[model samples]
Target chain A: MSVQDDLETVEWDVSEDAHITVDNEQCITCEDKPCLHLCPAECFDYQEDQEGGIYFAYEPCVECGACMVFCANDPDKGAVSWSKAEGGKGVEFDFG
Target chain B: MTDVAFDVVVVGAGRAGVAAAYKLADEGFEVALVERAKQPGMKNVTGGVLYGSILDDLVPEFPEEAPLERHVVEHNIKLLHGDAEVSIGYRDLELREEPNYTLILGKFDRWFVDRAVEKGVTFLSETTVQDVTQEESRAVVHTDRENGDIACDAVIGADGVNTTVGRKTGIQRTMRNEDMALSVKKVIDVGRKTIDQRFNLDSDEGAAYIYTGFPQGAATIGYFIYTFDEYISVGAVGGLETLRWLGDEGYGETGTPLYSLLEDFMELDNVRPYVQGDAVEEYQGILVPEHSYDTLPDRHDRRVALVGDAAGLVLNKGYTFRGLDYGIKSGLVAAEAVMECAEDGDWDAFGRRYDTSLEDSYVLQDMKQHRHLPKFLKNERMYDAYPGIATETLRRMYSAETDASGLTWRQAYRAFRRSDAGVLDLLKDGYRGLRSL
Candidate 1:
């Protein structure tokens, strides 16, 4: 099964508001978008339609902070801004 | 900074944050704990094993009401190449008690935070710390909520692997992908009876198994399986570069995405049977501070000290996992340092004692001992070639059928090396592994 399929197996409490945002322009310049490659959540996807840009979402995020941590280290500063969603929001683990 | 301040403010109510808050409060220092999650442990996850004698110091006895899953008495490490595998394990009754627990963070941290709460620690849950600024006499913590800013004599940034509080204190700079290991874990519901029979454990006894070199596995990735109460936690993690390699390799060896590698590992003959009808309980991913110890974030900086993943204290001792132990231990150490500064009434050099105290503890020493391990692990041959060498050689040696006049152990060993690795490379790895591990 795909990661999405496995993710479907686990319960999720999706937050309407997002705590993370990406600067797509900066991402276009990023030689290798680590978030698209490494984020287990698959929150960021490469959308060639936007001139080889990225399609970003935070609802599926496991809130592990990998995406933010990776993006922050990029020389293209401020490409990704991350924070924990407001209290009682974001992905909550049942058996974390 | 507002006048609404305490003696100490511990950021993030994780293992380290709670530990520091508990110790500080018991010492009669007014402590404030702010957690981004609605409650403690809600935002936390770990391929967690609480080994070593650290938690005993925090909670004399983890209350029976505590959600401690199991006591891991068996240490199993294996090398998997396809369905066939080789593992060497040790199970001891003496090591089954306190501190050696299989913890589910969502439960354990709640129980632990309560212990701190009883000591008069004021907890601010569902509060996000916006920024932390260190001043001459105290550190000011600004929160997203109104009147949430707190001024404290000291700040303990146990906020976890993604460090803002740490960077604010200048204790940690920008963290690179090379400095972390990324993982996605699933808690599968294999019945208690199935777990017991499959893992060969008595009731409440758990086994942690680490496997390397599965069919699609590389030198950088490791698959971990742990029997957790009614759920079996199975997962994988590797260095950032290695994961990048997996990403670079389109379709990988499994001819699918990276997650497919995990499903593939699970579907193998040896793995598939154990969890055939098991349900998937939970799935999540985390970025852990398993970077080489040399890249460890500064332990403390002036009035602001770091602990847990924020401090980059997790040690990836090859297959063995140890993070929460250091996270909790350093909380106690951070508490001691914070108290010393509070007594002296000096916030500038407040946590100066943390460096020396950690040096005196086994935490720093353990990281120091295995400082070279990260580089050793990067040597792809160890994971790529070694597991195959070990399993195949053992397979040929153990087979009772007379195959080519039944080679001796020494001859079989040479033959295994002949296939994948040469003698020189194997010797080099052994020498490096010895010095590093």
Candidate 2:
């Protein structure tokens, strides 16, 4: 099954506010763009038609914090800024 | 909506936070347990096993009262290569009552937090802690809600790997990529009868399987499968350092995200049957601290102490991972340290006592003993050359190529060296294995 299909099995309380935002312009300058690779939820994507070369949606975030850490350690500082979804407003695992 | 005051305010109501809050409340100290999730355990994930002996000291009627999934009676560690596998395992009936059990962290943490609430600890859910500021008279924990500032004598930081307390307090720097790993898991429902027949278990018995050598073995990614009554948790843990190093070849340039690695593992011929189920129950992931003992801070400042991942207490031994137990034990110790210093009316003694108590306890002692494991794990040969050596040697020894005679040990060793690794790689890894293990 696709990742989108896999994500459907878990529960999420989507928030109107984006808990994580990506500075796409900064991401283009990033040489490695590790978030495109490291995120377990595949929340970060590369989209050529976008203003910058990246696409990010916080809706499917499992709140693992990999993107935040990996991006912050990159040479370009970090294009991604992350915080937890307001309490009770993100992924909630029924069987973690 | 008024600002509340308590003797102790514990952050992140997972295993560590609840442990500290429960003990302090039992000791007659007013405690507040702040949680980020709507309920305890919703935001947490582990490899699905809890070493519960340490928990018995705090809750006497444990294994009986806990929300456990299964009693782990079998343990296996296997090395995988392509379609081949080599494993060693042990099963003991005595293990059914103590030491280890399979559980869902979401269910277990909620039950544990409920116990703390019953002990008179003020439980606050759906409240996010913004930051904390310390003043001369007391420590003030700031939260995101109206009048959410909590005044307290002390704070116990039990938040997970991405700790707000660690960063805001300046006690921990950003974790190095080498020191952390990304673990993604999926819980599958295949029914109790399927679990019994597939895993060869009785109604209450469970099995834990650990597999290494995947993603071509260069990345040191490990996979785990644990049997729950009617579900199984399957996942993979890949080191950040190696994943980044692999770069285009491993994570990004090659278009292989960490989650896809779990997919690849699940589809493997050897692993498919065990995990094939009616449906995927839940998908989850978390950042794990690995081989971090040396870099861990003192874990305390005057009235604020840290426990669990916030204190960098997780240990990733090559064959097994131990975090929940350490988190629980440290929470208990942090509570003891708080009570001791409070009785003496000396907050300055908090650090010394917390550190000394951990050193005297098994938590820190075990970490100190395996302090060099991170360095040992970095040797690429452990993931690549070693598994190849074992699988190739076995294949050569068992094949009946020649008419009658079987291959000798020396012949198999020669063929193995010819296929993948060399003498020097073997010697270096063998010696290092002896020293590290």
Candidate 3:
């Protein structure tokens, strides 16, 4: 099954304001976009439009904070900014 | 828009935060337990076996009353390379007499919080702690709500691996890629009778399986399956730094996708059968600390003390992964120190007492003893070479149709030598493994 199908089983109280924002300006200059590959919920993507942009959706984010350590923490590149959703807004693990 | 005050404020109502809140409230200190989730553990996930013995001090009747799934009496460790497998299985009735249980954290956390609330802890659900600062004589916790600053004598930051408290307080700076493991997990339901028949268990007995060396290109990634009554928890854990290194060396075409890895792990020849017909109940992901104990952040800053994953107290020793126990233990230790300060009216010494007392406790000692494990877990041979040696050696010895006739130890030795590693490499790894465990 696809990641979207798998994520469908999880319950989420998605916030209208995205908790994670990706700067495609930095993404256009970046060599390796680890966020696309590392996110467990598959919330990041490489948008291959004419500009070669980066796409991010916070609705399915598990709040694992991997982007904070891998992408955001890099001194040279600030492509990602991550934070937990507002209180009570985010995926709720029924069986965690 | 009214300001509130408490004797202590425990941030994040997971195991550590609740333990501290419960203890402080039991000791007649007004405590506030803040949780960002609608309920405690809603954001928590674990491929876990909660060792319940440590809870005796906090809740003596936990085993009988807590919302536990099953008492585990069996453990199976498997190393897989392709279709070949090398495994060790241990089952003991005496283990059931102890308090090892496989459980759902979402349910367990809510139950534990209720007990803490019974001890007079004010349960502040749906409230996120934005920042924490220590002023002259009080610690101020700023929340997302307007006029939500809560003044307390001390703040316990048990916010978890992606800790806002740790970052805002500046006690923990950057968590490197190498210092954490990202896990993608699923909970599958397969009925209690099926669990008993497939795992060879009684009504209350459960099994845990740890699988290593099979997700082809991902480094330091392991798979685990734990039984919880009618639900089975399956997941894959990989160190982010090692995974990046493998990607740099061109392991996969691109960086490893953790969700796909979990899917691949479930499809493995050895793993597929157990979960084949199960219905997916929930899918979750979490970041756990894989850093050495020495690399863990400072546990306290003035009146704020970090606990559990916020303090990086998790440990992975290849054979076992422990965080819940350490989280609870450290929370109790921090609360004890808080109680000591209450008696002496010297809250300024909270940090010193917590450090010294924890240094003297088994929690820090156990972590210090296994400090070498995180790096050892990143060793390449652990994923590629070692499982190959074991699988190849046993395969050669067990094939009766071959010329060697399945009855030769010498042939096993020959098979072992034909694999990637040398005897010297084995000895070095053996020594390192011994020291790490």
lDDT, candidate 2, residue B44? 84
Tell me the docking grade of candidate 1. Answer: medium
For every candidate, what is the interface RMSD in angstroms? 3.5, 2.1, 2.5
lDDT of 2 by residue, B1-437 (tens): 33789988999988888988999999999999998788788888888468889888799887888889899889888888777887889889888767588988878888999899999999999888878777786888888778889998888899888888777887677776776888888888889999999999997899999888786665568899999988998988888866776635443464456677788888899899898875888888899887545776657777778899888788777667788889999999999998997898786667568878988889888887777677777776777777777777777667576332445677666656665567877787677767665
What would you estimate as the lDDT of candidate 2?
Answer: 0.81
DockQ of each: 0.53, 0.65, 0.64
Clashing pairs in 1: none
For candidate 2 chain B, the 10 contiguous residues with the lowest summed lDDT are B247-256
Error of 1 at B244 (Å): 1.1
Model 1 chain B weakest 10-residue run by lDDT: B249-258
lDDT of 1: 0.77
Which ranges of candidate 3 are over 4 A from the true structure?
A: A50-52, B216-218, B245-252, B405-409
lDDT of 1 at B211: 74
lDDT of 1 by residue, B1-437 (tens): 39597989998888888988998888898999988777678788889688746766567666355688888888888777655687889889988554587888888888888888999999888777778887776789988787878998888888888866877667787777677777888888888988889878897998888877754347667878888888888887766656665634332221123465677778887777655654777788888776676777676777888888888888877668888888888888988888777677666776678877977778888989998997897776766577766766776677765363555676567666576678888788899999997
Best candidate, lDDT = 3
How do the candidates score on chain B by TM-score? Answer: 0.94, 0.94, 0.96
Q: Give the number of colliding residue pairs in candidate 2.
A: 0
Highest TM-score model number: 3
